[model samples]
Each structure stands twice: as C-alpha cells, then as structure tokens.
Target: MTPLHLTATALASAVGAGSAATLDALRQERSSLAPCDFEEIAIGGQIGRVRGLEQVELPAGFGEYDCRNNRLAWLALQQDGFIEAVRGAIGRHGAGRIAVVLGTSTSGILSAETAYRARDPATGLLPDWFRYDGSYDLFSLSRFVADRLGVTGPAMTVSTACASSARACLDASHLIASGVVDAAVVGGADSLCGLTLRGFDSLDLISPERCRPFDAARRGISIGEAAGFALLEREPLREGGVALLGIGASTDGYHMSSPQPDGIGAEQAMRRALASATLDAADIHHVNLHGTGTRANDLMEARAVNRLFGSDVPCASTKGWTGHCMGSSGIVEALIASLCIENDLLPACHGLETRDPEIALDLERHNRTARIDRVMSNSFGFGGVNVSLVIGRPAR
Candidate 1:
C-alpha cells in the first residue's frame, strides 16, 4: 500500500503548549516534572500539569460537562493554528470525509472520581456542581472533540493503555490509505487524577525524585497528563510536511500489566515497522524510546533497541521532560519525533546522567543537532501491546 502523509501535527505536554516550548525544553534539557501538590493522593515525584486550564471558560452548551481532560484538549487545539488546520481539512475534504480518532486510558474518569466523592448519603445522588455524567464516560471525549470540530465522519476512542495514541495513529493512517476517509485527526488526551496516582503507588512504581530514564540508579516513573493531535492524509497537502512512512503493532499477551521480559514482542513490532517502510534497520536515524524510567520498562526497551538497531541509532526517552503521560505519551513522543525530523535536531534524555552498563544502546544524554531524515517512535503498553511508527522527511 502507498504510504500516508502527516500533513500537520500539534502537541500539548508537560514541556509546554506547542512545538516551540517543547523544543526549547528539549534543547536545554529542562524537565517539567515537579512535586505534586494535590492532597487526594500521597504519591511523590513530579507531574506534567498544564498551567492555565483553570483560566479557560468552556463553551456555553458544554457548561456542565467540563473537566480537566476536555479543557486541556480545548486549550491545545487553540495552539499553532491547529484548529484552523482541522477546519481547513474539513472544508477541503467535507466534514463527512474526515475522521476523528482519539486514544486515552483514563478519559474523564477524574471527573467521575470528583463526583463520587461528593455523593449524597441521603439520596445517593451527586451534587449539581459535581454532576457530570457525560464527562465520566470514555467515549464522551472523542464525541466532544468531534462535535466541537464538526467532524461528521467515523469517530472512535482507543484505550490500549500506553499504546493507545500510537495505535490511533496507525488506525488513522490505515483509514486514509484505504480511502475510507480522505483525512484523519488522530491523537490522545489524559489528565492527572487520584485514581491513577494511587494505582501506580500501589504497584510501587511512583518515583520520589524526577524520573531518570536509562540511568543506572533510576527508581520509577513520574505520572503525567497531556493531549496531542495530528492530521493525516493520503498525500501531502503542503510541501515539506513529514510523511508517515509506516506503522506496526503487535500484542504479546504475556502478562496483564507487565511487558515480556525478553522484549521479543517489542523487537517484533520494530521489525514490522521497518518492514512496512521497506527499509532496513540501518536506515533508522533516531528512536524516540518508550523509556518510562521504571526498572522493568527501561530495561526491556533497552534490550529491544539493542536487538533491533544494534546500538547504532541514537535513542532517547523524552519522559524525563514530560513525565509519563500514559495514554497520551505515545502521541506526545511521536510529535517530538516529528519535530526532530522537521528541525534536524535530536532531543536529549533530560534526566539521564549515566547510562546503565547492562544496556548496550547509544542513549542520547545531551542535546545534539543532527540531520535526521527517518526516525522511529516506540510505544509499549500493558498487556504487552507494542506499537512502532516510522516517519520520514517529505519526499522530494
């Protein structure tokens, strides 16, 4: 099949609102993670909290359904002419010719948790202030975004843990390539909540200090929240836009919440992505690794990178700057990779001071400029779901 092109992309992560802030943070090796101040959960470490969500007013019709997740997406859509891009796509292709696909793990569950805490003991009904039935459902997020953008074509939500957004990109590319849709808006959004904080704490994966991916003394991961979106089309609508060369996905089905120890599934996913791109492993210039900073996740990804690219491709995990955004991590990192392609620079692993001796891979520990053409982004999720995407510079 002919490859689909990514006409435009935008990101909202802990680093900042758009590509400029993200690139600045990457260049300076600055981390957005800081101690959490929320009292609901006692988990320690840094979190990627968007700064100004509280200031934005929701649309008139969606007053009662507002939540942090939706609010963040709304704020992000306003950046980098992203909303205008989506509107243009719809106008050119017709609203029915565009599709909306979003990936999220928590959705708006945070709003539900808030409402649950305010339940009335007498009537067992939540207060009107906390009433948000539509905000609590996972499907509502996609619906909200679709309705706001007036996209009338296929709309769906993907929830595959960490690989959610990466798989969303895969699905969007497939739909455009198959002519099911002339264009697609693909990305993910997730907001911080007590449920996730405690959930990770219960598993002993919360770090007290900033996360240090690939560091020899790394402890665990720092949870984060983010929203990212991209526009994909069958052909380039503008010159010099990056092309989505190929995407590969696989599931090991090994464990419920842990990855395969041998990294076999991850290696397979990378191999498949290379195959789909019709390029050998040597063709990959950089890798945006799924380095969560947890002991197991980083080790497994290191092994997978070593096996797939033989330590030649420069790889770095941007989680140190953005924290682990969970479901939205894939799209955030994928956008970072896209920026690398556009600017011909490689982002540094912000918190990585020393490399683990056990891992035999070239980890980028400092900001470095390079002429990057082809790059790969890896997203491995719980249940051994793995996704790899290969993106290249626009074809000349």
Candidate 2:
C-alpha cells in the first residue's frame, strides 16, 4: 500500500480533546478510566467515558442527525482547528473529490434504545420522530459526517468489530491511490449505552475495576467511548506531520471471541505491515498492543510479538488510559503512536501494576525518552479480525 500523509488530526476521548491533552496524560501516566456511570446503568467496570458530551450542541441543520455518537464526532472535529484544516482540503480538492470513511461498532443505537422505552403503549410502535436510518444504522455516521463536511465524494463506513477504523485508514489509502479521491476523511466514533454494557456483562467480559492490561491479575475489559478524526492525502499539507507507512489486515478464522491461541494471525498482520512498509521488525521503535486486559488477548498478542520482535521493541497498552474504545480503538491508538514519534516518548502501561510472567512483553514501565521514528499499533477484534498499522515520520 502507498504511504499516505496524516495531514491533520483530532481526538476526543476519556482523557480530553486534541493531541496535546492526550500526550500530556500519557507523559504524566494519567488515566481517564472511571467507574461506569454511563446512562445511570448499574453495570460494573471502569470506563473511559468522554466528559461533557451532553453539553455539545450540534451545528444548525444537523440537529436531525443528533445523537451521542455524532455529538462526540462533532466535538472531535472542533479540536485543534481540525474542521478548518479539513475545509482547506475541500478548497484544494473539490468536495466531490474528497471521500469520507468512518468506522463504528455501535453507531447511535443509544437513540434507538431510548426510543424503544418511549414506544406507544397501545400501538407498540416507536415514536414517530424516531429515525432509525439516521441514528442506528452503521452507515449513518459516515453519511452524517459527509453531509456536515459538505463532501460529495463516495462515503462509506467500516464495521469489522474493533479493527474497523484501522481498516478505514487502509480503505481510504486505496481510494486515494486509485484516483477515486484525492483525499479522505477517516475516523470513528462509539458511544456507551445500555445494550453494550449489558451484553458484555452477560458475557462476563466486564471488569469490576480499572483494567490492568498485561498484568498477572488482569480479569476482563473496560468499555469506553471515543471519537477521532484524521485527514489523509498523498502529500503532506502541513509541516512535521505523521504518515501511514503500512497497513496489514488478516482473519484467522479463529474462535468467535478468542484469538488464535498461538497468535499466528496476529503475527501475520504485523509481519505483513512491516513488509508493506519495506522494513523489518528491527525497524520498529515502539508498539501499541491491543491489550484489552483479557487473558486470551494479552497472552496471544504477547506470543505473537515475542515470536516476531523478540520482546526487544518497547510496548504498552493505552487501554488503561482510554479503556478500549472498541471499533474506534484503531484510530485512537494510531494517534497515540503518532504522539510517541512526534515527542520521542514511550508511555508507561498506565494500570499495569504487575507484569504477567507468562506474557513476555517488554512493557514500558515508566515514561521515558527514546529515538522513535517508526511505530506499530495493533488492533485485533472479535471473530479473528486483525489489523496492524505502521506509522512513521516521513523520510527526509
């Protein structure tokens, strides 16, 4: 795959908005994971819920598309003058030539969940004002963003579990390289709701406390909500920006929720990403593990990295800070890795108090300085969907 420049970026997660806030949290080892208070649910586990989404007011004419998910997206776009940067891209490449691609496992199903509670008692029908297509559908997020951004080019959404947004980046690169579009808006948004919490709880995947990824005492995952956006182009539009050096995606046909116990599929994705970048495992300076604080995920990923990189590459799971943003985990972790390159800092595994002896991961124990030029972030999802992204500073 041709490398594409990440011209501009924005992020809104449990830590805060924009790259500066996120970087500060990482450097200070500050985590945003808190007890689950979302929607007043009695669900257990700490979540990286974004603060103040309820106060965000949508722009005029976008009210109909309003929901927690889209609201979070709007908040993210307002960060670091990201919308202005995107508008400039629109001016350079006509709206019709700029595509939009976003990823999300749960679009705005929260709105539907609310609507269901308000259904007509006699008719057993949802409210007349309820719009399922606008809020609940997977494609709704992309459509809403395209219209809001005034982009007339092809618009689509990716929903391959947790690997969704990272795959969106790959798809966007393909569109640009194929001349289907000159540039693309790529990101993802996932908001917390009752359904997801209950589902995960029923599956016994919800942790009762803050998640400790790669820790010997690790138990389960902590659900979170976040939205991030990146503008991608063939050339850099801004100085000192990051680029998508390589992308690798694979499916091992493994268990529904359990990874290939041996990590073969994860290994392939990382290897292919390095190959696409025209580099080797030795070239990568840092790694962002898909350490969801689950036993199976951490163990499998540890085996995969040990097999490929030999535990030489410094790595950690930022899920302790952001609590696994699920489908949006791809872009969020990518941005975190980009911060690592730009700042030359390796963040500590926030909540990992004790390393799991079984998983031979060279987890970062503290915030430290390093010469980081190339980094890989892994995003492996349920049902064997795996994606590895290689991000690096552009060659001189």
Candidate 3:
C-alpha cells in the first residue's frame, strides 16, 4: 500500500472540539462520560453526548440536512482550522481530484425517529417536513462534507458498524493509489439516536456504570457519539506530519454482531497490516486495542494481541474517555494514534482499577512517556469486521 500523508486532522467528541481539546483531555485524564440523559430515552447506561447540538444551525441552504448527525460533522469540520486546510487541498489538487469517503452506522436516524413519532394520528403518514433523503439517508454525510468543501470527486459512505470510519481510511488509500483521486477526506461521525440505544440495550450490551476496558470487573459498553476526520494525500502539503503507513481489513463470517471467540481474524488483520507496512511486530511502539469494556470483546482482542506481539507492547482503549463512538471509533482512535506519535504520550486505561488475569497483553498501568514513533491501532466492529492500521511519523 502506498503511504498517504495525513495533512490535517479534526475531532469532536463529548470531551470537547478539535484535536487540541482532545489532546488536553487525554493529558489531564479527563473523561466526559456521565449518566444517560439523552432525549428522554430511559436506558440506564452512561453516554458521551456532545455538549451543544440543539443550538447548532446549518448554513443557510442546507436546512434540509439539519439533524444531530450532520450537525456533528459540521462541528468537526470547523475544528483545528480543518476546513481551511481542506480548502488548501482543493487549491492544490483541484476539487474534482479530491474524494470524500465517510463512515457511519446511523447517519441521521435521529431525524427519522423523530419523523416516525410525529406521523399523522389516523393516516400514519409522515409529515411533509420530514426529509429522509436529506437527513436520514446514509449518503447524507459524504454529500454534505463534499458540498461544504466544494469537492466534486467520488463520494462514498461506509456503514459497516464500528469499523466503518477506520475502513474509510483504507478505502481512501486505495482511491489515491489507483489514481481515482489525488487526495481524500476520510473519517466518520455518529450521533446519539434512540434506535442505536434501544437496539444495543436489547442485546444486553449497555453497561450501567462507566465503562472500564480491560478491567477485571468490566461490564459492557457505554454508548457515545463523536466525529473525527483526516485528510490524506500522496505527500505532506507542507512537512513533518503523520502518515498512514499501512492498513489491513478482514471479516469474520462467524457471527452477526459478535467477534470470533478465538480472535483469529483480529490477529490476521494485525499481521497483514505489519506486512503491508514492511515492518515487524517489534516495530509497533504501542497498541490501541478495541477494548469496548465487554467481556467477550476485550478477551478476544487480548488473545489476538498476545498472540501477535506477546507482552512486549503496551495497550489501552480510549473508549473509557470518549465512550464507544460507534461508527466514529476508527478515526477517533486513529487520531489518538497520531497524537501518540506526535507527542510521545500514552494514556492510562481510564477506570481500569484491576487488570483481568486472563488477559496476557500489557494494558497501560499509568500515564507515561515513551518513544512512540509507530502505533498499531485496531478497530473491530460488530459482525466480525476488523481493521488494523499502522500509523507513524512520516519518513524524512
């Protein structure tokens, strides 16, 4: 795989907006999780909801696209002067040469849920004001982002659940490598919606208290919402930025919403990623495990990493800080990887008071400084979809 430089990055989550805010929160070990209070949903699990979405308004002509999800995307684009950096990419590559590929599971279903609730009392028909195509459609995110950036190249939306956005980066890498586009905007945004909440609750995966990944007493996931993006080009627009060294994706036909018990698929993804980067297991400075605080998920990932890197590499999950950001988990953690490379900071596993004795991988015990130049970040989505990315500082 051809390495693509990450020109600029942005993040919006419950902690705050922009990559700087995320960095500050991680440095201070601040977590934004709180008791569930989203939209009158009676679920007891904690959630990481953005601070202010109701007050956020779309630019004039995009009112039809108004929804919590799109609003989150808009907020992310404004972060870290990311929109300006994208405009600069447009200037360099031309709008027609830059593609937009975003990932999300429930793009704007919140809007659809609202519309469904307001159906006519007798007719059972939705109101005329409802714009499913604009808000709820899966393509809304890519289209809105492309329109906002004035980019006219290929636009795609990936919906493979949690692995969505991380896979978006891999797809963008292909587009750039195949000459389909000169540059690509890759990431995802997911907002809190009743459908996601209720569905997960039905599956008995919602943790009542805050999530504690890799902890012996860890229960389950605390649902969260977030938006994160990165711009990828053949080379750095300027100099000295992180780049995607390699990406590997795989599928486990084993189950619909559960990972394979043995984690063979997860190990395969990491091995392939290392091979793709022309590196070895010893080169990975740290790992960002897909530790969702669930028993099955954490155990499977621990086995996979223990098999691949043994106890040499330190690992942790940021879900405890941001909660599980669903479709946005990939890019959120990818950005965290970039931060690790850029700042040499490895975060402690938040809420992890006791380590699981069954897990052999070295989970972070404290916030410490390390020579973190390359990171292997893993994202394992529901239904056995998994992606592993090797991100590091660009070569001199």
lDDT of 2 by residue, 242-299 (tens): 8999999889796888899899999999998998889889989899998999888899
Segments of candidate 1 deviating more than 4 angstroms:
129-133
Candidate 1 residue-wise lDDT, 209-299, digit = tens: 9899989989989888889988887768777778778888899879977888778899999998988888888889999999998889889
Query: TM-score of each candidate?
Result: 0.96, 0.98, 0.98
Give all candidates' CA lDDT scores. Answer: 0.84, 0.89, 0.90
Evaluated against the true structure, the overall lDDT of model 1 is: 0.84
Q: Candidate 1 or 2, higher TM-score?
A: 2
Off by over 4 Å in 2: none
The alpha-carbon deviation from the true structure for residue 262 of candidate 3, after best TM-score superposition, in angstroms, is: 1.0
Q: After superposition, how far is residue 259 of candidate 3 from its true place, in Å?
A: 0.8
Better of 2 and 3 by TM-score: 3
Question: What does the lDDT come to for candidate 3?
Answer: 0.90
- lDDT (10s digit) by residue, model 3, range 297-334: 99999999989899868888989999999999999999
